[model samples]
Target: MKNIIGAKLKAYRAKNGVSQFDLALKSKGKLSTSTTSTAETVTNYDPRLSTFIEMYRYVDTPFDELLTEMGYGESYQSTWYKRHKGNS
Candidate 1:
């Protein structure tokens, strides 16, 4: 699902009119010292959950609205169950 995450990240970035480098810098600031170095190493367009959360904080869109825009609907529970039935 990296592609999906990447698309979502790109959409959010565009909505905020920020570049990938700027987003990366903002994400890096949200990390703790131990994870700071690793966080800063993210050079690709893919974004982590924490990074997305931080972005949401700066944007006018709500979390659910963003998720819906990303094609993630309210059926998350059912979707998760289907993807990991054996593990559960």
Candidate 2:
């Protein structure tokens, strides 16, 4: 499957004139250059959930939108919610 999340991340950064290095910097150690790089360039990489959360928050995208864009159905959504809901 295509890495839609990565593509969206790249697009968000590009649209906002933010470089990967700057992204990491702006994140203030919540994210790293290597992490951003792998997410953007690694075709088959499945990033951790926290990474997704951080990136989504950083780019001001809604979590529901992210899950939807990833093509996850209701089951996955409920599971993800159950696992991460109160933890947020």
**Best by the TM-score measure:** 2
* Candidate 1 minimal-lDDT segment of 10 residues: 31-40
**What is the Å distance of residue 59 in model 1 from its true position?**
0.8
Expressed as tens digits, the lDDT of each residue in 1-88 for candidate 1 is 2223444455666787876667656766663333333333444534577655664555566555666556676665377655775683
TM-score of 2: 0.73
lDDT of 2 by residue, 2-21 (tens): 46677777888889999888
Residue 39 displacement (Å), model 2: 0.5
When summed lDDT is taken over every stretch of 10 residues in candidate 2, the lowest stretch is: 57-66
Instruction: List, in order, the clash count of every candidate structure.
Output: 0, 0
| Model 2 pairs whose backbones collide | none
lDDT of each: 0.53, 0.75
Best by lDDT: 2
| lDDT score at residue 87, model 2, on the 0-100 scale | 90
